[model samples]
Target: MRRFTRPKVIPLLAKKPPSQLPHLSPIPNPSLPQPPQNPSPPSPILTLSHTQNHTHLLTFIKTHIKNPPLTPKTLLHFLKSKLHHHPTFTHLDFHVFNWASTVDSYRHDHSTFEWMVCSLANTARFSELGCLLSFIVANPCPCSDGIFSCPRTEPIFRFAISAYCRVGRLDDAVRAFDSMRKLIDGKASVVVYNILINGFVKCGEHDKALWFYERMVRDRVKGDVFTFNILISSYCRNSQFGLALELFKDMRGKGCSPNVVSFNTLIKGFFREGKFEDGIEMAYEMIEFGCEFSSVTCEILVDGLCREGQVEEACELLIDFSRKGVVPRGYDYYGLVEVLCRKGNSERALEVVDELWRMRNVPSLIACTTLVEGLRRSARIDEALEVMGRMLEVDMVPDIVTFNCLLQDLCNLGRTEEADNLSLLSSTKGLELDATAYTILASGYSREGKKKEGKVVVDEMLDMGFIPDLATYNRLANG
Candidate 1:
């Protein structure tokens, strides 16, 4: 975490080591091609003071390695260790790395520079990070000499751009992006632009992202599907549906077919803008375009329409589309089913579940619970019991709330014996009764003045830590 300070120059009377070591001939000059070799272990370092002079540093490397003709691998290993172990002396690492790069026998590879940039970025040392990047831009790595140059440059700048943008240093990110452009062989690819566009959008610089997209278009860099998707998603987020639609159309005109995500975004936007019908129409259009429906499309259509109080329309659209094989199978329609039951149309809801069941679509646990509660609320206790039976048959266990509702409803109707029987039935079905279920039965017994039966229920409730209210105690006492 320490800032970079210029190391004071110390004069040395020792003779300067040859920039090219004299004795070793096995190590290929980096200026010439060399077959790859395994990297060697680092030289032991006792202090940073010995490394300030390139002469002493080169001699130190020559003398310390156990076995090496001093290949780039060995030199990189040595330098990386110093940087890794002695982070406080990173200022010296830059110099040692530069000196090693100057040696014809060893040049810094992409990994070396990348490690340096990553270290500087990770440490939040932006001043050194910028200087190192500038150095990379000016003096391309020796391996990046000819045909191999542009490809290697991409990752370095891409990493730099991502790192810079992550810290909210948008200006530095842009500079790195510009440097990346100058290094590529042909027109900058959509991928590089996508990185910058995504970074700008992530930083909430949407206008800047659009501006960069415009620049990309003007520069004749063709946008890909990802490019279109990012922009459309951004436009949709900024409430610029008009612009989003325009871009969607523009992408198609450019022979870039809209994908499912494109359709989903625009459709969701349509719903958000209160254009539910338009959103549905868009879903149909997507199907006609051979773009498959995703789970999100189903959610948007069903949730959007139901929220607008057109639950029946939403359900019908799904069933109708599903029958035609337009909407993808296996989309969770439980929410829609629950919404229907909640709207007091439990009979119609049950019918819908039957239809789906006939088509081999099993009801979800929530759908079963919703139906049970809805039937009880409608005073159709027999139908509620039938739904509960169906739930048990399907292995869809009812939750405590569902059990409580059925028991409370039975108790409310002066059917204490039936409620007690139902409680026993739920236990046989693995639906454990909670304190609320016992209290409901106990209260029901007290109301009927069945002192023996009621006293047993109250004792059971008390055993389960169910403290009855004073009213219930008085009723028991009076009974």
Candidate 2:
């Protein structure tokens, strides 16, 4: 079967209209509020342009009408499939929709109304969207004429309301919501109320969000967990921790289970209030409630406690969490290690790394590097070497600069053979060895008077394409 390809649309200014295969038109029209009926006459240029657009639309529609009378579905298909993608014609969607409304025979259904609403909304055309909403409100979907309201009407306005809220047009969003509630058969869904509340919250209108929440309750609408979460976070943001606590309790009484977000919010609120114990206590409560700990939860706990100079407590908490296997594997615990090392407590940092590593919670490369540098600074070479080996086994290699520094340390202490082994291991483990790495090892072998080993190191450097100069290579290689 041959595939049919849509022809490129002709430019609006082009005199010659393109030859058309088949296209589209409309069926019925709904009278709507455009400009006043007895308005000023159009200019000749706009008149000509309008006539050309109308002629183009009519030509396409007449050619492509599959059934006898074009329905809203067919019209919508033409809008999306044909005109919507066109550069010049795309902006004329509303005009074409108006043209459809002019057709006395075809009445639009929800499909057409929703398409236009979403199209206007997605383009951030609020002024035009407001007019479209007025049109939708004045001409309710035919389905609303039945006993039950149009199920789709609320969703369309819901989308529009969200769009309005996104642009901080809270007033317009409320107006749209009120209009939607009137059109729908019953109370609006809790989700619509939540959107309005969230919109207010996002605009820093916490009081308004609360007022709206009260209105929702009085309207006999029930908020789900998501609704409670939004309000809870808003309360915390407003510095109403006491009220936030009360609302949290009410949430439990209402059988809305607090998720990780709920806990994280309150925990952060506690930290802000300088209630360290309370913050940590609530984290423990999260465990009791069987809520999975999020990475943010750990951050709040670690950062909060450490900020208050309770670094050891933070360390204990992380280790405890790891023992219970409750720690997120992706968490590196680098912050705690850095804090510990910064406080001149590298001993504790070492223990923390060792304990966590033994529990199979792998340290990130930075964590391993940090821990290694801390140990080396405190001259704990044995422990640093142990950590390095374990990290290399897991394919967690540090950058070459760090490896070279550690090699220099080991070689200065007469452990060049071990440094040589480390260099070899890091190379095989994907850490590219620079000339300095082999030079350090070569110098160490020279100091130890191991000419065979020194020459061997020089030979390995040559094989790896790292020759400094013939004289330098000869002096070191002959040593």
| Deviation of model 1 at 227, angstroms | 0.9
Top lDDT hit: 2
Q: Alpha-carbon error at 367 in model 2, in Å?
A: 1.6
Models 1 onward score TM values of 0.68, 0.86
Report the C-alpha lDDT of model 1 over 1-479, residue by residue, as the tens digit: 21133222221111235454432112234466657655963221112433234345455556655563456566567767644575454455555554444444344557777776776777777766777777676655655555545366777777777778778898898888787666566676788788888888888889999999999999899999999999999998899999999999999999998899999999999999999889989998998899988878889999899888898898788777767666555667788878877778888787777666667667778777888888887889988887787777766678998888887887887888887887777678888788778778877877877767878877776666665576766554445
Alpha-carbon lDDT, every model: 0.73, 0.81
Q: Which residue pairs clash within candidate 1?
A: none
Angstrom error of the Cα, residue 18, model 1: value is: 5.6
Give the distance in Å from residue 59's predicted Cα in candidate 2 to where it truly belongs.
Answer: 5.9
Model 2 alpha-carbon drift over 4 Å, by segment = 1-68
